[model samples]
Target: MNLGTIGIWSLAFTHGDRGEAREAAAELEDLGYGTLWLGGSPGGNPSGDLATAADVLDATDRVTVATGCVSIWEQPAARLAAAYHALPAHQRARLLVGLGVSHAECIDRYRRPYAALVGYLDELDAASPPLPASARIVGAHGPRMTRLGAARTLGVHPYLVDVGHTVRARSDLDTTSLLATEQTVILSTDPEAARHQARTMLAPYLGLANYREAWLRIGFEPHDLAHGGSDRLIDALFAHGTPEEIAARITKHTAAGADHIALQVVTAHRTLFARTAWRELAAALC
Candidate 1:
């Protein structure tokens, strides 16, 4: 729903103190970001993602607030729909629900992920206050799921991806579907320091099958995924160096056919560094 060219994606806004999260959301809006994406997968609690979206929506006036992704396994489709309908029409219009099937390792009964996602969408469609496909996005990586996203939902929101995957995703989806990609950034000039921070954030992803397979398809070698990823892999997956450098990297994604880029600034202390990174990035990109 009009997620601008660039948006801030961070778990800090969803999992942090309410006062601080509200303050940060307002500040990002003031700084000219088009959307505020609440990162992190929601638990079984029905209100978890909705509460975070509400907090950010209440804090900012024009900026859209989206769940970078809510795991379908975590929250039921009916419950998610109920929560969406519960919001005032005005607020509901500004919120975008991004649903994901999550990883097999994380989910207990992760069989037939594609079928499960289709089933979840079916439930949403059958609900009393149906959650329109136009108002939601799917976390898709593979071709089949990407096609499903285009056919059933707004579009695909591919995470931990490079420009190559962005281009591929654009080709897979119809012109009407959106191609929103998540980009991790580290604002550090030192090569070693930036790689260290990038590796820390990437280590968990390397172990995830979906991410590793995606990386390989995008031209990464097997060794590139080992030992927390090679320098080439880190460099391609993350945008690091000066604000200008990071901005340039973002341009590559947009040039490759990405409609929107959700920028997640990597840091050891998320609460302390997120706003600071956003301020610097806004200056360079906004």
Candidate 2:
């Protein structure tokens, strides 16, 4: 997992046009982002599929393309393992599979999530050739899963996190494990405008218990999670303002113990190829 200091995680990559996504991915690699995280919503991809990851990997030569996470309950280990082997050797080399036990509210079969994740790992281990632990990542936030990620796979990919949680997660794992944290940002100078984009992007997540618990554990109060998140909550989770200001916030994660920061830029208009924002951020970030 040679993911450098910065990567781009895009929700639109999974939601928009594939051809455009491939082209954007190639450009991002040229821009110097180490990884391209396919940001799918919870219980999405319906079958725990890796097709989107495959598309990004096929388009780029060097940058690692990750799932951000595909749910265990949604896709079987054998099917996922098979999909991994289906890619060409070159593409496979640059692919990173991120797995998670998504929120119970979104998954009907969600039960004993931790235990289920353990079992899923077991199944993957039993697969033909197997999806190598070195090529996979765990979507973890809590202590137990964070430790599991350190011990089992490449490392943890924590989403919707603050500097406080990154520090604690690093403490839970040994220094060798990759602490790839996803950061949401809005490249806007106006406070009101930024919050609106942040809130719109945050509303669906607020209802998910997995992220809710992670936020609370990091010292966010119940009030912070209310009504599309409080100003304090929005401010804490999102990095807004100019490109330089946002870059500074992304750096906070690195200082707090993050090995890699997967940057997700949120804007009022949703599009897969967010070239302008990526280009601007790369000037300050990469």
Candidate 3:
């Protein structure tokens, strides 16, 4: 995998205009972000996911475009593999297919999450897609998927997790496998203001069991996830401080065994505003 030190993970296309997202992609590439990661959310359609990757791939020269995850239920993995393989050679090399068994509550059609993911990967493999194993990733948290990540793909893409989870995730994968984790960041210098913004952004995730379990494993209690999120929980989940402090938090994930950190800046505004934060973050991290 050619995953560099850091990547910008965004839901901009999911929530904002595509043109704005494309512009942000170009700007991030200019700012030296190595990859652009697009994630699948509940009730999201992944035609947008492919389009987001295409827009970023078209806008930038060297930066990779990744689906931080496209749920197995959302689309056939074979079709996704075909789309990835059909991109220009350079784009194909720069494109990463990230797969995941999404939230149980959201998957109405699939009865077995694990089985669906396994079948999806099997279909992709049977297709003999152009991308190599190194060019694919999986959204994994618990041990079963973590081991499957090692056996089936490049590595794991864990979300809303801390350094402790990174440590365990790294130990589960082969040393060469990519261990990429998403870290939420807030650029404000005021702790109270930052956590306030982080809480608003993180509220939905705090209720999701997948993320709640990960947080609990890192020592947060159920009560910590309540009422926005406890100070300690917000502080642990989001890197809220000066730009330098935020960069340190992202780098800590790397030191804790993450090969690349995909950053999601918790902001109250638009893609360009978020891109500004990304610029500062890239400068500090790179």
Candidate 4:
């Protein structure tokens, strides 16, 4: 779908009021982001995710809208396909559906995730108006799933990852697969302040085994993953410094073979609007 080299990933679009969300989406498009990725996993009900994507589509003229990932266990393949087909052709063309087999800790039905994902893809293919493999991407981390994503779907969208993982994932993927990675950025110059913000955003992820395993696979020691993540781990996963420094960190991902980098700006206030950060980053990176 030509998601461009840079995009903005935000959870606010999923949870915010429609009017405000639309305004933010429009501003992001005006700022020249190629895609707006709605962050946070969609729960058992897929309606919210679809509606959010629709809102962004309605508000923006050209930028693509994607679900950072909708869990396969939560949202069935049939219903998701139906929703995708219902969209107008232009909207469908711009929409990228990112699917994931959620963590074992979050879903009771998380057994044989790779097999289940294959079955889900089978269902999608069987739908009346099929959801084409090119229209979707998989949220994959490990080599096996990453390879599966390359073979079965558009490519892999690895979340909470560093450039090192991007290098490894690129090596694992087929030449045709798209490699999109998410990077969290905290725009504070103070070392302690920046790390504090990074630690706050990273604490919950440290508890998720999926993310921990991905870190270990990329050469992180146990100590580096503990106590809200060591400085080394946080530095690797997040770009925290001036705008120029953050821009440099993002370039590393592009050099490591990431086709797209979905940048999420971290702020101390969860309710703060990120258009300002988006504008600054667009000036620096776009």
Candidate 5:
């Protein structure tokens, strides 16, 4: 699928009001976003379930719909494959399945995640109607899994990452393949207000080994991870400020080698309707 240079990632599509989710997808498509990503969990929660793809695909005419990740442990290969095949041909063509071995903390069956993921992929290929390698991507953050994603799937979708990681990840892959990255943004000029929202959204991930390890690999020290994350850590992982400032931050990812940027606007309000922020970013970036 032609995932335009930009996409919108949201938990709203996964857990928000169904009717509003459909409307939002259509509006995002009209706003010129090339893809709509079903973001798993902002924090260390389980999210972006595989089933959410059908809802977005059915609601939008052309915007490509992708799961930020569908945990291999959550949905069996055969069942996910059946769901994929059930979609109308056109819709299926626009879908990208992001498969991941979610954090062990959240999964009761999480064990030897890498080996299990490989087995899951084997099963996907073995299903009656295979889930093609070209139509999927991996949620990879390390060298080993990154290499696997490059060889077997579309590419890696690294969430909660920074420009430096993008540079290294690009170096890890060949010229071909996708390097789609998800960026968390808080649209506020006030550092205090923005960081507050960011910290709230970041709290759950701080305790998750997967994300903590990823951050440490990318230059964050132990001190940076403590006390709800230092200013530097929050600043590095999240793009906060005005729309233009956020756009500039996102551009750094592109310059570092990201093929597509998935923009997710997180707010202090518990509500998932972030359309206002979405529109502002669309104006500045898209």
Candidate 6:
């Protein structure tokens, strides 16, 4: 469950294309990163999503691959269970399935979202091809879901979050459970320019209620959430500065009790994997 450091969280598929999700995975592995995390897809067949992870597992030898999460509403438990069973036993350990009960608006056609996830886990447990409980993680934010994650999966993968929520989530789970947080990084020395970039990049999450509430809990004011984000909000969530400063931000998440901190470089540069942002941060942290 120790999904390793400096993974890519590209929303590239949204704006354009991922080429092959596995191609990015292969490059990330070659970059010396320890994991490849993919998400931002609201709904999709679980098997196909799991197959994406499988492609990465097949392409690389060391790095673990995870869904930053796949919506429980979109995919069935049996589907994920089958995918988990299809992989070689050794490969299975390297594939972590992160599940989530997504936003209500996004899950409109699904029945009883929370209950549905509980049922899905139950069905997964009951399935002929069940995954080891340790191979799956949950995308939980609030207390109830956090508790569910603690009980049902390996740990929690909370997105658009900070160390404060990481602290709270760690407290909610058993000490052994994993808490891998996603931290956004933009390597810019200018404070105004750094935050401007951070704000523009964070515009979408600012609209999600789950993220809005989580930011509020971390002391971000309602006004701070407006438009893009206030400078203060941007500064706290996005790690922007020198590479050393970015490493310091990632370290803060570890200090706050995160088992792993997924570093995302916020840039329009498609060649980010080959660029300085990833290399500099990787050298600094790992």
Once fitted onto the true fold, the runs of candidate 4 whose alpha carbons sit more than 4 angstroms away are: 42-49, 269-272
List, residue by residue over 35-84, the lDDT tens digit for candidate 4: 89888642322432488888889999899898878888887788899989
Each candidate's number of clashing pairs is 0, 0, 0, 0, 1, 0
Residue pairs of candidate 1 with colliding backbone atoms? none
- Tens digit per residue, CA lDDT, model 6, 1-286: 5577566665442223345555666766777787777655444323344766676688788887787677777777787788789889888878888787777546577667668878888988998967767888888888788888888888888877777788888889898888888888888899999888888777766767777887887778899999788877887788889989988877788888888877778876433342456667667776
Candidates arranged by lDDT, highest first: 2, 4, 5, 1, 3, 6
Lowest summed lDDT over 10 consecutive residues: which window, candidate 5? Answer: 42-51
Candidate 5, residues 216-243, lDDT tens digits: the string is 9988899999999999999999999999
Model 3 C-alpha lDDT per residue in residues 153-179, reported as the tens digit of each score = 888899888788898888888887788
Error (Å) of candidate 4 at residue 278 is 0.9
Total clashes for model 1: 0
What CA root-mean-square deviation does each model show from the true structure? 1.7, 1.3, 2.0, 1.6, 1.8, 2.6
Shift in Å, residue 23, candidate 4 = 0.5
Candidate 6 TM-score over all chains jointly:
0.89
lDDT of each: 0.86, 0.88, 0.78, 0.87, 0.86, 0.74
- Greater-TM-score candidate between 4 and 6: 4
Q: Give the clashing residue pairs of candidate 2, or none.
A: none
Question: What lDDT tens digits, residue by residue, belong to model 1 across residues 136-232?
Answer: 9998988999999999999998988888899899999999999889999999999899999999988777777877887898889999998889999
lDDT of 3: 0.78
> Which candidate, 2 or 3, has the higher lDDT?
2
Candidate 1 overall lDDT versus native:
0.86
